[model samples]
Target: MPMTVRSNCTGTLPSVIAGSAYTCSRCAEPHDGPPLGYGTPAPAYWNVEAADQPGSVLGEEQCVIAGSYFFVRARLVIPISDLDAEFDWGVWVSVSEASFERMSALWDKPERVEEPTYFGWLSTALPLYEPTTLNLKTKLHTQPIGDRPLVELEPTDHPLAVEQRTGITSARVQWIAEQILHTNPPMG
Candidate 1:
């Protein structure tokens, strides 16, 4: 595929929000809407309280530093189908465009794509690891100490660790940690 640096924001949004209900002058402009590329939305069940509400774009930024082409920041509302569920969480997703598109294409389709390109939860607004240290540590920690990967994450007191304890999609957190592991695996 030819990688043209063409800056155009074009993709499928929820059909429900296609018209005046969600119309914005920005949508017509390339630079105004979320950066154009492949991506997916946060899961529908990320926020249980906003069952009736739709997910909205909070912001987006190109992030070469993090290794992703772009990151779509969104406020996901995971609907509460369980009547006993007490409340919902206000969470953000830092995801790849390819992942976002997969979710978007299945917005109202009968067959939905369960997997996205990649994404991670914003367990907390605070930075869990410093940029410089994160790169080095993710590489070291994901390595195997014995039979299992070390996973000796630094600053264990960080909110991300708390998110792990609370079951806020630790898979996503692991995905982020595994980036380095996948990029540079052990040579045997």
Candidate 2:
């Protein structure tokens, strides 16, 4: 199932006060009016291979996560060394950029950042993971096609990467680039 809102929100789903609420644009249930008792923001927290280097970092992104669907805003890349033919590497977590900025300003205080609050990778044969839903889309070089991100895949690329790019829309990428990210959740 697509993610939903857990907070008991009031007013329109994305009210002027709190900006916009995140959800899986394709599969998420609509919040017609106020008092949103249950909803799911796209997975906001993620640990992924550093986009520029060897180490990993915790990052936030705007993306969708639902049964079978594993899309993220950032172009997630995993090193060939990290892939395994038989393993279910868990899920990556992330948040929106707005949330990241909010938390950054209040970084000095440990209690300031919130969970799922408002708010990369490297290597050759790198597999790029992009969002496939418009409502959950982020401002990236690649644009959205209908509800899915516009990404190109090559048949000769890494088998797993090819799989992620070609398999079911929601098929899980066996090699998760985000797991090696933050050893501990960022700002946790």
Candidate 3:
């Protein structure tokens, strides 16, 4: 199939907001609305919360640097039916569009395409690409270690899809983790 860059996606979100209420409907132009901060009108979806965009242009703390692209930094994909119990538990990785493009090229083979996201999905997954690395490292430095960045990855597979398949479609991802662990067991 020809690679068609999706300037659009069905019910897809560009980035994740940390603290803001977002109102979106397929009927609206700006489909995804602005961040309503904490304690505002709740989002419409029962299984979803508002997408939070920090007020600062800065991806982290420094001034907002423009241009390029960066990942919508996430740590984990918690499976949940209700919104309150989901949790992020992994590394936050961001990469420039150029590097992301390169990685996409490397991983786009038919064999690997089924398991993850490729360049095609990168645009939507890591929306705004950054122009510099000074703040990038700073963001990483300030982040806690250990459960820190277990892995930095572009969003490829939809967590929703996985949730649907496992019959583990609830807020307890730890249960899924436990299932995984139990199936494999510790090699003691």
Candidate 4:
């Protein structure tokens, strides 16, 4: 069932104002979401644009948490000798330039400067209980994608000389790179 509203001359849902709300005409999905209660309203806060059909979230999905410690583990190239991966070793990832760009568009806000992490990496062939650091240098852009201030480093720089690091592997990186990017477009 389509919700009725005063659309604009363009025939699209016009921008709604304060106190505005939407609901299904037949079953009526009461619009009982959160954030604001009185002063303002919901739609403004619930600006999740639908894609495939309507009311779908995955359309702009980025990260799908897998409930595995691997995904959230502190991303750093801890050397195999230093780690306690007695029965652990896989890979890890969080966010980066490419990933952050897409996420920023949907979130429509700048990420906090103090955001815990900014990179990902792969784990060693073995598991460990504690983490270690790799002297093999890394980098972290002082700004977001469009270039603000980028920092560079050398192999000896390691943690002190690097900005942020991760545990991403060459294979996993290739797979993820393929998924996020598109290769072809149709002619109009």
Highest TM-score scorer: 1
The ten-residue window of minimal lDDT in model 1 covers 139-148
Q: Which stretches of candidate 3 lie over 4 Å from their true place?
A: 1-73, 77-79, 97-168, 171-174, 183-188
Q: State model 3's lDDT.
A: 0.27
TM-score list, all predictions = 0.27, 0.20, 0.22, 0.19
Model 1's number of clashes is: 15
Cα lDDT computed for each candidate against the true fold: 0.27, 0.27, 0.27, 0.26
Which candidate, 2 or 4, has the higher lDDT? 2
lDDT of 2 by residue, 78-174 (tens): 2223222222111222334454344345545544423231311111122233433223212222222211111222333555445434442111321
lDDT of 1 at 104: 46
Candidate 3: residue 183 lDDT (0-100): 41
lDDT of 1 at 54: 44
Ranking by TM-score: 1, 3, 2, 4
**What is the overall TM-score of model 3 with all chains considered together?**
0.22
Cα lDDT tens digits for candidate 4, 5-111: 12122222222322334342333543321101011111111233322333322212132222221111111221113222111111122344454454345343356
The runs of at least 3 residues in candidate 4 whose Cα sits more than 4 Å from the true structure, single-residue gaps closed, are: 1-61, 69-92, 95-107, 111-119, 122-188
